[model samples]
Target: MPTCSAHAVVDLDVTGATISKHLYGHFAEHLGRCIYGGFWVGEDSSIPNEGGIRLDVVEALRALDVPNLRWPGGCFADAYHWRDGIGPKQDRPVMVNSLWGDVEENNHFGTHEFMALCELLGADPYINGNVGSGTVQEMSEWVEYLTRDGDSPMVRLRKANGRDAPWKVPFWGIGNEAWGCGGHMRAETYADLACRYATFLHNHDGNTLYRIAAGASDDDLTWTEALMKAVSCLGCTSRPRGLFQAISFHYYTFAGDGISKSPAIGFTDEQYYRTMVKAADIDRVIAAHSAVMDAYDPLRQVGLVCDEWGTWWEVEPGTNPRFLYQQNTLRDALVASLHFDIFHKHAARLRMANIAQTVNVLQAMILTDDEDRLVLTPTYHVFEMNKGHQDAVSVPVHLVEAAPAVTVGDQELDPLSVSASTKDGRALVSLSNLALDTDTTVRLDLRGRAITATRARILTADKPQSHNTPTAPDAVAPADFAVTTRPGAHGSTELTAVLPPHSFAIVELDLA
Candidate 1:
């Protein structure tokens, strides 16, 4: 039997990074039911809807305070002709989603629909332009269509269709995954093409387009260097801040080879440990890429955008393989919490991260059935619980001899992971106990901040495979957490929390 008791001290005075709200962002591509049935069900559907979009989904997303939504594609954006999807639904062109699924894309939910949905959710829209198969003129016209306030052909067309006013699209991706599905082009070639497309992508309606060049996949430093160099050369004779403000990086956590990933539920303990290790690799990826960016832009003028991330598992049993839909479980919640902790720790280099998807897709926050029933997955609760870390000043914490490692075969993994933030006289601490059999008692010493009140919300289960289904939707959900506290000798508050195995928790403290 292993006794899982850990002692750690957190200093309130030690603070550095300011966690951007965008770190809690989400991604929605034109893939699977993520767009069609998952979000857009048409105004006449039997399901309760608001302007063709599901009102239930909208309200659920609003609860997360979803910061930004990347749209038009994952691989779909590059081949997507925005013009085809923008007009009367009857007149819209039908196209095939070649990369995602071989199914037909009924251009019903196009530019206007996406922007409208964003407005309803109060989330910013991050559009990925088609640089792979699209021309510079096409990209320019698309931006002009959505954002141009002055008189223009695209604007005239937009007005004739419906919307009288132009929308403000702040974040723009020159291309997505240029090293792979985007174009299969080398770094230098893609960089040149990105510069050309970004050149014609102008600022519209007093809205500065924050252009992001397609960036590295994993630790491919050359990709980062080449893109940075290209942008730097363009910046020398161009504006002081140049065109591209950020670089996009895409990383997905799947341990198995190729598309054959681990199962979504009921995996061995060793398999679970390996999955957690792969999830934590984002920190290393960000650090390596940031160092390359630092070499070129030492002022950290450009930030890193983890536009595509999340666990990709084998599709749900009998569904279309290309749909990329998988059930969310406690493992996913832990993985999400780990990524958020890493993102919060590296807030300086990382400005934003949009999980691979939002609904009915890879590691989705919400899962829906054919009967219009919705289940808030374990990952959803993690985001809802840790939402306070958004835009909050990140308080650094050091774990001192807290607990031993969980040894599985040749791998060693820490049992406790934590991240702290301070906002409005409140200290928010997010924790994860990563062991499979032991529940660790974490003794927290709030060094500089005095606690007046404390409350915690935890997402856990009796088993690692515990999850929500339509039949049992509340199988693994958040519940009130109780902690023991006492006044320490040095006028510090000592708090003791029992973190169960494979659980994620958010502890909030009101400071006096």
Candidate 2:
């Protein structure tokens, strides 16, 4: 393949929406070792933990400035009972995690433990309430147990469990996937259930809840329409803030084949292109959902939350099939970059998003072994590098000369993706080149700003499939990239960088 050339113009003056820091949120569920070994290593373990919450994992995630963490689920949330996980550890009941590997859940990591983890990471707690097999009273009491203070049955129970102060929980979920693992209900049925649940999810002690109704899978716009229609008929003239604050949907990138997914590593070039195509299609999916929402909510009062997303590939050969653990490679990093680009563009309607799982699961940021060893994946570096864009005002990036497209069968994949944002007198521009063999030189006509200084960083490896293991954790880490700044036409600062194949880069400009 030949080298490609791409040109883009960044409008520094035309800032659109604030890219929510919650968009960089993460999900942690009870599946696999994600809870047991990934985050909870037992308070008695010698692996150096802070009250059974692994210190190393907490310290690693703290660097990303994690905004919010969704807990106890994907499908696991529907089956989980908050009451079972609270109080003394040894006294807690143990149940079979029937959804994920037939392993027993000791209920050691309960409500108090999750809130403790959030406090350590300085992130807001996004608790997913049980809706499938749980009653409304159970879900209502769980919220009160966590947030209500003064005098109440739940508050008394919370104090009895060793907590006197109320915790501030801003985000809550009505259910998981109500259409499938979350109880296989129809769209309209789930909509009614969501309204009923949200009614009793009262705010307590000045703590407001941003309730998110479990939304569609992939392209199931009917689910979104059902929720929107339900909210429209609820007698709310303006926003749907009272009934539900947001609607959440899940999207996972794969090779697009119906049956098997491409391996996380050792994938062919064709498979890589196909994955990129699938990743890029999220833009259209978000647009379609937003349009459906616009019909009922033109003012964009209700937020769109892509609560569960990221690549889902086949598990490692020796790992349990239900564990959902997979290696993260350069391709995974590129996929993340592509999603962030699309997310930044949709920041107005898109309020928050959480990657599928944070550790030892599908497209995780950190991978852990059986012992005390841990390795940061390439996807972690992307989050760290792009952390500057959190809550920053997104600026417009117009492509003048687009990157060459790679054709994989009937699908065409653009090798380049870009997004820009400005915050605190500085501007950040992120770029990703998806081509497996070609280098792309990207030119940026930085309009409406004078650059005092420029800094650049790039994350790439020799191959798209290259990944980091415990022995070589920095195999696909980011490093200082080379970017040239020169005078451009019409008083704009011109910047250029040659991005390698399967590479992701960010340019930070100190604007005048």
Worst 10 residues of 1 by lDDT: 232-241
lDDT of 2 by residue, 92-187 (tens): 999999899999988999999999999999999999999999999999999899999899899899999999999999999999999999999999
What would the TM-scores of all predictions be? Answer: 0.97, 0.98
Could you tell me the lDDT of residue 298 within candidate 2? 83
Question: Which numbered prediction scores highest in TM-score against the true structure?
Answer: 2
Give me candidate 2's TM-score against the actual structure.
Answer: 0.98
- Root-mean-square deviation of every model: 2.0, 1.4
- Per-residue lDDT for 1-512 in model 1, tens only? 25588887888777778999999989988899899989999989999888799989998999999999999878899999998988889999899888887889889999999999999999999999998898999989988898988688888999998988999899999988899998899999998888888889999888889898889887888888888887664324333248688998888886634334678885777778888888887888999999887777777778899998898888889999999889888988999999999999899989999998999999898888889999999999999999999999998787876778877567667878999999999999998998888888898888887899999989999987899999999899999999888997588999889888888988899998
Candidate 2, superposed: residue stretches over 4 Å from native:
233-237
**Residue 216, candidate 2: how far off, in angstroms?**
0.2
**RMSD to native, candidate 1:** 2.0
lDDT of 2 at 393: 100
Report the lDDT of model 2 for residue 5: 97
Q: Where does candidate 1 stray beyond 4 Å?
A: 233-241, 256-259
Q: Cα lDDT of all candidates, in order? A: 0.87, 0.93
